[model samples]
Target: MALSLCLPLLAVLLQPAASLYNCSSQYERTPDNSDIIVECGTHTITLEINLCTAQWAGFNASNLALNGNHNNTQCQGSVDDSVDPPIIRYQLPVNNSQDNPCRQSLQIVDEAPDPSGPFSSFSSIQSVIITGYVDTPRSDVGLISYSTDLYYHFSCRYPLEYLINNTEIVASSVSVATSENNGTFIDTLKMGVYNDSDHIYPLVVPSTGLELRTRIFVEVKAVNLTGNFHLLLDHCFATPTPYNMSQSEQHNFFTGCSVEDRTTMTNNGLSTVARFNFEAFRFVQHRDRAKSSIYLHCILRLCEPTNCQVLLSSCNARRKRSLSPFGEETNDSATVSVGPLYTAREDVPNAAAYSNNVAPGKDDVDVAGLVVGMVFGSAAAALLVLGGWFVLKKYYWVGGRSQAFE
Candidate 1:
């Protein structure tokens, strides 16, 4: 009974020390590129510190770990002070690796995620934040309290951003048509419009434009392609006619970049599916024209399990430089078209244009009906003006006669 009581008391006393253990440096230094070199692998991550360089940064370089298991001596690396430069190296698995406790450093979290993906991870190239601590805490850090730690940290990044030379990057974009050229046809893709944000309700647009400023939720998907790949869109726009280079256009997104303020590129290169939303708009040239139609077109490509996410981000960086298409160029991009949709008025959504209940008398207002209503309204206005003039004339004449009698 005495031994059990003592054991519980001992655990309580040691809990704080164990919890407080962290690899904070002896002193803080301004972040620099030469601080440490990092290597990110397919399933593992390696961190190396130079003894000569770390000494100037005041790194504490002690009590390093490679795995959570205390007995996993194969992973635990050595720290030697007697060496000339005193190099320290640690190799461990990434957080998402199959080995649950094998990773003792480098915790990665996704910055971009896809909800409906077949793979265990939503995207091949996901934005992630990798964090790890090096060395034990010391009093020289200037903070006396245990609530704070001065461990080394870096901002969120893509897995392929600093990958170990295993993947190739061929990220280039140019304007191209997604139609048949030289008898080449691309039938591996599909594009559609949805009525809800969840993308569950398919929206069937009119044969011509849609309502002004209605949220046009769109989704572009890859069909028969296999393996891990991401969809990269070069351009998507609304043209007054079938997509020819010779017409006024409103860009929903250009090169995976949003041009309109309300346009949201919710998912790009995140999975096999790419989703975006834009407000419905009529072409400036066709705003006053009735019976006009709008056509939607997009040019997109598929990226293998490499740095596609980073590639899309690069497109966003130079968005302003490539706004207009100078000429047509061709690559692996596929073109898909939707719509010949027309908008009737602000009151009607145009989806109700061709319903079974829409009889000729209820929905169709011919030119004759409009002309008769205008003629009646104009005649009524003229009669009201004549009556007002007669009343004023009679009142003034009566007043003058009364004054003469007085």
Candidate 2:
């Protein structure tokens, strides 16, 4: 009996692992499968498995994706025949973007360092999770959609920010994954100038010369951010030269207040796009220059979607009632500086022209017309009265003379 058992075990070990697959259903237990192989690299996760295993289970490896979220990821297939049973390999890139192309999830975990903890280990770790799914759809089950979708999730984790030794692991090709970068958060936030209040037409310089009181529509947007963050404008001001705030700074708006009441704005804390408009103006100290450039700098904050609106409302309310200690405000703010906004006091309406074309909605009583009408009416009334008196006198005098003649 012992000899027979030993012979059977040797035969089983010699057999190809692919032919021994005993998949219970479409739901594959990938991690437990001795045939499936995985290697976690610094920026990539690669997986290889027997194609026959997937084929026999009525699932296509090409159709399987990292997260089952089709928009975020797609699988490409390649075959290797060096071994007895052919294997399919997928190189999954660990990436972060508007669409997490690999559909990797992220987590931050705190860890207590062990006594033998290496210097390279961190007290807290951030990890990227990679998951793949093999699903089988049964059409016989009337439109219940995925009613028979048999799938199981298989995943691996790499605590990011830790250095890795690439020499230990070998690969045929090394495709670099786009790592999530918070370093250039400022670069991703863009500020722009527009001509129309609706932000339709762009404000072109030289062609559309900056004149005093020219409405300049401005917009700041999150261009490459995948997370939802509301942008809040703490203050926006213009200085004479680029980045020299020590020079005369002309403030357009501050803490939600339009300083001169000459600005129009949308809700800053409710959208990723923060927008406002102020008339083109010259720096006070640089007003004498033939042409000067205005540097616009804005102090802004990016807040979580949950707290932005309420926080903005509270701060603005305080600002409206009275000035607060501006420096003591919350700290997660970023500053953006846009320079060389060539502004020359051109196309300025002279005082005389301005007075002549006074805007409507003013009490403009015409004094000259009133005086002319009054004088003409009085003179006509007096003339009529004098004529009536003369007529009466003539009548009386004529009658007396007739009596005397008689």
Q: Which candidate number maximizes lDDT?
A: 2
lDDT of each prediction vs. the true structure? Answer: 0.50, 0.52
Query: What's the residue-level lDDT of 168 in candidate 2?
Result: 10
Best by TM-score: 2
Q: What is the lDDT of residue 56 in candidate 2?
A: 53
| True lDDT of residue 169, candidate 1 | 15
- Model 2 ranges with Cα > 4 A deviation: 1-184, 244-252, 256-260, 319-337, 346-406
After TM-score superposition, the amount by which residue 123's alpha carbon in candidate 1 deviates from its true location, in angstroms, is 26
TM-score of each: 0.37, 0.43
Please give the TM-score that candidate 2 achieves against the real structure. Answer: 0.43
